[model samples]
Target: MNKLTTLNDHYALYVDGSCLENRDVSATTPAAWSLVIVTGDNGLGKGSGEILEETWGSVITDSSDSAFIGAEVGSNNTAELTAIAEALRWLLIDGGNRPAIVHTDSQYAGNLATGNWKAKANKQLVAMVQKLWREVGALRELNWSHVRAHRGHRWNERADHLANRCVNNQAPMPLSFWKPGQR
Candidate 1:
């Protein structure tokens, strides 16, 4: 297993984003960003794993967010940046004081947040996420980690599922653990 993919094992924060516009770029289609966050698991039963939030925003005109998203909101990079911004807001509200890493499959999102890469395409969205990252960092320890997308890792899979749900207009649901004839 690659070291990067093991972020779920070490960090409490994992965020993922999905964009519908990238998938179908039809002129009439709405490009929405679905973001999912996993805080961590406590090694307990049904309530062990806690997902902080599942957020969806229209890249074109998501009233939930400010108008700063600008004209390139339909881009996948913008969607990924939106997810990181949301996660940072949640961490600020959740009062995360300990060290935590934000895992993302989008290299653009991770690098922009971590300052490892400069923003060339989605300047507004990237700046927004970087701003949020700095704000969140002031309140707590934060790290950025990039992972391979579409892998079968536990948290990543769940994050991807939640992100896709927004495009499908489906609400986030709990994972079913019961299996028939498991005994």
Candidate 2:
């Protein structure tokens, strides 16, 4: 019966879910990348009471391009994080920029993004995200933030939809969503 409506609520969800990354985020760089992750059960409603509940999860990643890129129905946190990180990588390299912000619906993934925390629950996915983060850093801007699910935020909602597509294996491949004429 919880409905997310504000950034504070999203932050609260991350804190309450043991989902927030537990790492040291004191490093500073001259890049600006904003990542907003949206994770939660698929088919979840906004406290409508009549909506059915589903146990599916998804995540979205976007940069300044305004294009939607993400995945859905992750088998676990690792899978979801990997999907999101990969999407960011493609976007950054193709977008031709430095220092990028990465958004995710997963606190676990967020932790890995900033190195404020390490991936313990899902080692493989964590490794994947770590690799992608490094690659993105080598290319352009990289920022990390966690967005609460079903919060109704424009980017977050889009991410949620994209993530759902990913979880369902319905998302377009990274290359498919890539913008043309950008190496």
Candidate 3:
């Protein structure tokens, strides 16, 4: 069973390898209306018995021009995408009278959001993400981009690191450690 644990907010975060920034939230602070999404990968291989990890991030310009809103983490593309959408829903939708933009590294997610492509095998996921996007989009503009991973974007680099950390921490132990007659 997964026990309750105190999670470090810094665990899946990247800011500048040099400095960490704090994100503050307030009841009246408006959401980030314009944003960018960046993703990172560690080259997981299902074949040849290799498995890698994924990470995600978002950067936004909040109602207060001086504040830049952002978040990043380690996770798979699918999970990361969902997390991004949900974050936007909370920040952009739950907040009143605000519109915003969403950017992403997943062409699959971006294309579906803009009606540029059809859903592939993951119809349920597509539908759910789309629903969230539309919900938030209703309040703001959501434009997406499919940026190449690890091309030296500051936010993308941090997000990638976080994603890799998440996957690395959750990876399954090697079969060599199995005990005799273990199921």
Whole-model Cα lDDT per candidate? 0.61, 0.40, 0.37
Give stretches of model 2 more than 4 Å off.
1-74, 165-183
Ten-residue region with minimum lDDT total, candidate 1: 39-48
The residue-by-residue lDDT of candidate 2 on 1-183, one tens digit each, is 233343222211111111123243111111111222333322232221121111123232222324223222123353445445555555554565533344456676677655779655545446655776777666654555565655653444444443344334454234235332211
Number of the top lDDT candidate = 1
What are the runs in model 3 whose C-alpha is more than 4 Å off? 1-77, 92-99, 170-183
Q: Superposing every Cα of model 3 onto the true structure, what RMSD results? A: 17.8
lDDT of 3 by residue, 8-106 (tens): 110111111111222343222222111222223111211121112222333222334332222222123343444455445554534653323333445
- Per model, how many backbone clashes are there? 0, 29, 7
**Candidate 2 lDDT:** 0.40
Best prediction by TM-score: 1
> Which residue pairs in model 1 clash with each other?
none
In model 1, state the lDDT of residue 73.
46
Error of 3 at 96 (Å): 4.3
Order the candidate numbers by TM-score, best to worst.
Answer: 1, 2, 3
